[model samples]
Each structure stands twice: as C-alpha cells, then as structure tokens.
Target: MSFKNYISKLVFCNGISNSFKTFTALIINSKRYSSRFKKNTLDLNNNETFVYHLKSGKNKFKFYLRTFKGDIDIFYEVFWRKTYDRHLSFLKKEPVIIVDLGAHIGMTSVYLALKYPHSKIYAIEASSENFELLKVNTEAFKNITCIHAAAYFEDGMINFGNNELSYNQMISENGDPVKALSIETLMRTHDLSHIDLIKIDIEGGETELLSRNNSWLKLVDHTIIEIHTPYTPSDLRDDIQPYGFEIKSEKDSVLFAAKK
Candidate 1:
C-alpha cells in the first residue's frame, strides 16, 4: 500500500473533507481511532472497483476490488447492507470451519473473516479474473485460504460460463473448461471433518448442486445460499429439508438452512 494508493482509497471511500478528518485522526489520535469510514469506488487495472478502508483497534484493513457491477452491488450488500448477518446469526461456536462458494472478489469472505477471526475459511472462486482480486482482498487475513475452482456436483473439469451480470457466473455446457470441485472433495482436500458454515451463491446452479448426489449434507451443519431464477424456495426446501435442515429465506433473496 503506497501513499498515493492510500490517499486514493481515502478519497474514494470518504469524500475529501472526511478523508482529511480521517487522516488527521489517524495522525493525531491513531490509537483511539475506530472504523467509521466511507464507501465508494476506485478505477484500477482498467476496471472499476469498490474501495473501503477501516481500522479495528490498532490494525487497518482495506478491501480493494476490480470488477464490474458485481463489485459495487456485492460490496454494498455484504458490508453496508448486512446481507448475511441475519442468516449467520446462529453461528455461536468459535474456531469453526467455513467454505465459501462463489466468493466473488471475497467480500463475504472478508466480512466473515472479520466477524469470526478465529475461524478457518476457504474462499473459492471459479473465474481466474475474479480470483486474483479475491486473493488481494483476503490476503490481509491469515484465516482465509483461497481456492480457484467452481463448486459443482462433480469433481473434474466443467464448463464455466460467464453472464452479463458479473456476479452470476455459472457452469454451463457452452462455457470454457475450469476445475470443478464437489463438496466432498473440498472437505477431503482441506481435511475438514465437518463444516460449521458453508455459503453457496453460484447463481441458479444450486438447483443442480442440491439436486445432485449431495450426501455431503451430512457433514454440513449450516448453509446459506442465494436463490436465482428457476430455482424457487420450494426447490431449496425439497432438496435440503430431508437432510433435517430447518430452512428459511431471508428478505435479501437467500435461503439459510441449519440442522435441527
């Protein structure tokens, strides 16, 4: 983080006046500064990205991204809007293991890492482009491990297609080949005996995933997923309820399931 980039993030997140106030606070009251910053975007690597700067106690974190509509909406939804807080309210255990599917640029992973700093998190992304930024954002946290693979029902190469909406990329027959890992495979690769929280937001592809050979549900205690078109709430209920998850949908278009 260079001085130029630091000031740029300050300006992008907080306006000039607030940036000045934050700067002065940092220099004058460095030890007492709590994270009350701004939200805005930055132009980086020929793409626009959302930039947010925060300080927790004596440590500082910057979530910088390079993306399309995905950056703005996802960042706002996860950070300012508190999209997952409701779904995640049941997480009372510490030192838990988490797997994040469709971890686009790692906003959710970053948020979760901060919320559960002692927990281990695997942030998985399919797109090579998005994974780069995901790495950058999650690097500040030691608890987050990033994987470049799509969480499909099978463990092999699969067709990964893009969408006009940057956040909704999915596996398709017409798409390019990418490494596909299953829930079982992820657990095995990470040597995870059980997962405390697993997040799935792979567009509409969850229908196929939940419908497929999902014996892995036995190992998952809690899951939260965003439902897309053609994958209704009934579909989600029918797929996971038999596994004994008390399923409910939050207002922001996501379903959360926890073991009874």
Candidate 2:
C-alpha cells in the first residue's frame, strides 16, 4: 500500500471517526500529522533518513527513519497503534527493566525509553543496518543500552536473516553469521536479577527462546511478545503458565502475559 493509503486504511479501519478526535489522534494517537520542521510536528512521508525532532507533552522525541520503507509503519504501530497502547498505562511511570529482543532500528527501545524515563532498557538488534540506526536513534538516552546481537537459544555465532525488512528479521542457517545472545547470557551480562517487562519481537526466534528448559521466565514480571508461525499462543501459554504467568490478553500474534 502507498504511504497515504496505508494511513487511511490503518487508522480508519473501523470507518469510525470524529473530525475533532481523529485529527488529534493523528499527532501521536492516530494520524500521520506531517510537514516541515516545527516545535512539535509530525511527518511520515519523507523517503530519506534525518534526525527528526518531535515534542509530545513535555518531552522531545528524536528518531532517524526512512519513511518510504517500513520504518514509518513500525513507528506508527509502536508509538500510536492502539494494540500496544493498552500495555502502556501500567508502565508509564514505572522504573522498570526492559529487555527488547528485536530492537528494530530502536523504535520499541526509543518509544519505551521515552515512555519510561527511569527505565533501564536493553535493546538487542541483530541487523547491522538496524543496529547502526538504532545507535543513532538511541544515542541521546542514557538509560538505553544497545546490544548488537541476535537473541537465540544459546551463546554462539548464529546465522541471522539479512534484515532487508525491519520487522521480519529472524534467525536462519543460510543467513549471515552474527553473535547470538541467549536470554541467560543477556541477564548475566547485564547483571539483571529480575526484569519488570520483556518485549519479544525477534521474528520467529521465540521458539528457541521459550521452548528451552530455561529458568529466566520466573524472573520476569511481564511479557509482551509476538508469536510467529509454527508457534501458537497456546504453545506459549503452555510454556509460560508453568512459570507463574497468567495470559492477560492477545491481539493477533502479540500476547500479553503478566504474573498474577
């Protein structure tokens, strides 16, 4: 879909709108408010990458994005897509520890960092191109630690899908070899005793992440992960239910689990 058409279909998929409310949602909640630079402006139409400056509420948000590619889609999905918004009310003020499995050009990391200013966010990205942009986008935040490694079942060199597409990057035996960090290695390397929130979107790597006989799940309070094919929500629910998490809800493949 074209940039303009994608917005119309995505934001107004319900065909429900109010002129006053819909326009406001476009700024950060719904619409793609764009144009030249201003104090607090929005634009998701540019094809090139630039240091974008945006102000929402009292904070100024910055990100390096290529709007023509899938960057803006991910941006809108993370920053304004309502599917992820329901989880934010609980995290807005918490000084949580977050583990982002697929940082993807740092969209989730940057958005979460901005949302949780006191949070210590560990962003793991496997793509070299994405990691380069991740560093540029997240360099301003002191709380975010960017890790250029793929999340996998063990600590070793693993083949990773060339991240030509930002959201679908995954692990593959035929892809380029990259440093792999298991959940255990990540926790130990960062010296994290427990995590308040864990966001897993590492393409299809969740199979290796949760199917293992690992002890990390018990140490996390919350989890929001997208389950790719060959794995169902029931598969994850079965794996995590034993670890003390109750399945709160799900939207598509994204499941929300929290300790009860």
Candidate 3:
C-alpha cells in the first residue's frame, strides 16, 4: 500500500477503538474467523450514533456511523479498502452525467465527484434522515445535486421502510411514504439527453424497476447495482440482457452492467 493508504487504514482502525468493548470483541473474533464471520456474530451497541471525520490526502469526509447499523464497516470498506474503486475507471471523460440511486449519505457521489471533477451527479436518497446527511456531506461539491426521492418506475409517492441503517432502508407497502421518480423523469427534469452511469442500490426495489418497462435503460450507458438476494429474481440477468447490457457479478451483492 502507499504511505497515504497505510495512514488511512491506521487512522480508521484506531478511531474505532473509541467503542472499546465493540472494538475488543471485533479483534478477538477476527483472529478466529474471517471479518464477515465477525461482522455477523459481533454484538454491537446500537442505542447511539457515532460520527467520524476521515481524510484522504486533502479530501475530508464526515460520516455519521453506527456499528450496529453496519455503517462503520461500510465506511471502512468503501473509503479505506476502496470497494467501489472499479466504478471510477468506467467514466472515460470529463463532464459526464451520473445518477446515484440509493445514495445513502452521498459517499459514492462524493467519491465520484472528486475523482471526476467535471462530472455532474444527481444523488438520490429515499430516507429523510439520510437525505439530510447526504445534503450536508455533499454540499461542498458543486457538481453534486442531492435529491430526496426514491428511484421508481413512475413519478409519484411510494411507501418506504426507513431505518437507522441507511443501506437497509427499502421500499415497502407499510412504511412512510416518499416521492418517487422514474429514470425518464430524472433525465427530463435535469435536461440531460443521456446518462453516462446510473448507480443503484435501492434494496429489492430494483426487481420492480428493472422488470418493468425499461425503455429508459437505453438512455443509460452503464449501471452498477447492488441486488438484494432472494428478493431479486434469479432471471434478473436475463431480464436486463435484452436491453443490450452485459452483466458482470462482483463480490458482495454488486452487479455491473454495461451497454454492449
């Protein structure tokens, strides 16, 4: 690793020690099995939220994290381990357009904004609480436009399950209602002819959106989706194949589809 990356890892690992008990358990169990094993078995206190301000070179990011909510591990993976590093190389030019569905606290949007300085990004989040943080986290970037809405097949209201863990929030029939927007609406609203990339991680809502009339998918050049298992049909690959997108499954629940 480079000196900067080494320092970042050291800082992140050391910073988590503030939650001493949780940190201790993670250490002990991490030796016995894989990190995934520890993640599944560790008992983390969830009563309160924690904030961490992290820096990479001159770029700084503020994360409202909770171990119980798995935000800490996600921050570690995305920022420290560079889990979405592969997505960065897909955009080959400046002034590209990206739509970030399920933007969470705008981490991916921020990363992309910084990496592709000239790109215009629409960061969409469903949860009210997360949208507030998403706005705050991405405010410094002029290219990021944060939207408090869910990406759906239609432009209307939909029920959503809000939770402390932003990633776990999903569209449901029995949760708080939020406004939804279709890809076509988004493109028209933003006055964009085409989107270079659309990154989606809307829990299981992808099944409905992707399975529905996907004529708008033709306007997108690429997509990075995190498909929730079992809930998403196994034929999702086949479903998207006719759109001229070739699917490549990655580690975790991530899938990348590029127009062929």
Candidate 4:
C-alpha cells in the first residue's frame, strides 16, 4: 500500500457509498416505470429472442441480461470493471486460447468471446445453476467450450460446497470440504496446450491449485485471479515467481500476472 493506493481506496469507498444511494433510489422509484417497462424488458428465461444486441466494433452480439436487483447492481458494467476488466480487453486475435476458470454465468466468457472472436475460450464453471445459465448465454458463440467441472491440484473427486447457489466455489485445499477435481486430469483429458488468458476466481483454492500443479505455469501466458482467502498478497507473489510468473498489477483482491 502506497500513498496513491490508500487515496484510491478512500475514493472507491466513497464512490461505492454514493452508488448504493443511487441504486436505492432506483429501486424506490421502480413504481414510476409501471409493469409496462418491466414487460418490455426481455424475458431472458426464453432463449428464442435476442434480449439486446450491440455492435462491438464491427461484430454484432446478443446478450441476455436482467437489470440490477436488491441494490448490489449485479451487472458487469458496474462491479467487474474496477477489478478484472482493466487488462482483459488487450486481447484481439484468432487462434488465441483463453481459459476462464470459475466462469460464473458466462458473463466474462461472453465478453471475452465478443472481444476476441478468433480466439477459442475454455470456460470452466462448477456451479450447477450458474453453469446452466452460462451455457445458455454462450450458446451463440461457436468458439466457447464450456466445462462443468472444478479445477484443482490432484486428479480425483472432491466436495463442491455451494451454499450461496450464485458465486463462491472454493476448493477444499485445507480439508474445508467443498467440490473438488483434478486439474491434471482435465489437462490430460483435453489435451490443452497454450493458454493466452486465464482468469481464476475459485475462492482460496488458487494457492493450492498453483502450488500443486507446477506444470500448468507453462501452459498459460496471462492470468487474472481473484484472491479472497487467508493468504496474503506477498504469499501469492512468492508462490507464483517459482512458476515463472510475475505480478503485472493488482486491484482490490484481484491479481493480474504475466509469465516471466
């Protein structure tokens, strides 16, 4: 924590407070829009129609999304930008393979595919419900391959503790007892080679995954991971260096690393 980072946190805290106030106002004023406005919004449950279409550069894309609910904003343009999207958009080429570990609802997968159509995406999600929606949302993209499995250190079965039913899929590296899988098995099964961008948000399992699978470091070029456990940033820094990767940047709890 430098002086600049301290000041940035202060600003971000203030901004978050203000954004919550605004979101509260929107919810309170939802009655003003009436049922007509709600009806006009796409029925995302039905996959027949395009919810909304936007052209990113020249390519046209469709996305099935609902507005914010219960004051969390729950939307990418709001929450994810501050942490993950900063360096994610640098990709724009074909034949590039992206590994999306812990891909929740396929939102990041859709973004990656739309941003880099020529690239193939290997999206891994363990949550049953979220993975289903992820599959539905990404059905249009030909390049995205969805995997409904958790990535871990050893090759075998492990408990997937999914209490929230939304996010938070942590591998039980310390015997916490959650869903588990073998990363080595997946690698051997898929015959995966080069990974251009890898995004991991599997709770505290990142440490165990990285520490256990030392061979995987050679497969990936860039990795963006959300670290949300007892391990300090310095611990992660020390662990990753041995695998030939160095931290490129970090915001909040998320770390962006590039291969050395």
Q: Comparing 2 and 3 by lDDT, which wins?
A: 2
Please report, in order, the local distance difference test score of every candidate based on alpha carbons.
Answer: 0.75, 0.75, 0.73, 0.63
Q: Runs in model 2 with CA error above 4 Å?
A: 1-48, 90-95
Cα lDDT tens digits for candidate 4, 1-260? 47885466445434433345443433333333324345664332332221444344455554443332211222333333434567664434443878888877677777778767888898887766567767877888899998887778775666664333245545443433334556556667778667778888887778788876667777778888888768768877877787788888887887788876
* Clash counts for the predictions, in order: 0, 5, 0, 8
lDDT of 4 at 101: 84
Q: Which residue pairs come into collision in candidate 2? A: 25-30, 25-31, 26-31, 33-42, 34-42
**Candidate 1: TM-score?**
0.79
Those runs of model 1 whose alpha carbons end farther than 4 Å from true positions after fitting are: 1-46, 49-52, 56-58
RMSD of 4: 9.3
Task: List where candidate 3 sits over 4 angstroms from the true fold.
Answer: 1-8, 11-51, 66-68, 162-164, 231-234
RMSD to the true structure for each prediction, in A, is 8.2, 7.8, 5.6, 9.3
- Give residue 118's error in model 3 in angstroms: 1.2
Error of 1 at 142 (Å): 0.7
Q: Which model is ahead, 3 or 4, in terms of TM-score?
A: 3
**What RMSD value applies to candidate 1?**
8.2
What pairs collide in candidate 4?
Answer: 154-182, 158-180, 159-178, 159-179, 160-178, 160-179, 161-178, 161-179
Error of 1 at 256 (Å): 1.2
- Residue-level lDDT tens digits of model 1 in 1-260: 47985555445444312345444433332112111112323222345444556554444676664433446557656765578988787766753898999998898998888888889999999977788889988888999999999988888898886544557677777777889889888889889999988999997778888899898988889999998988888888888888888885466578788888
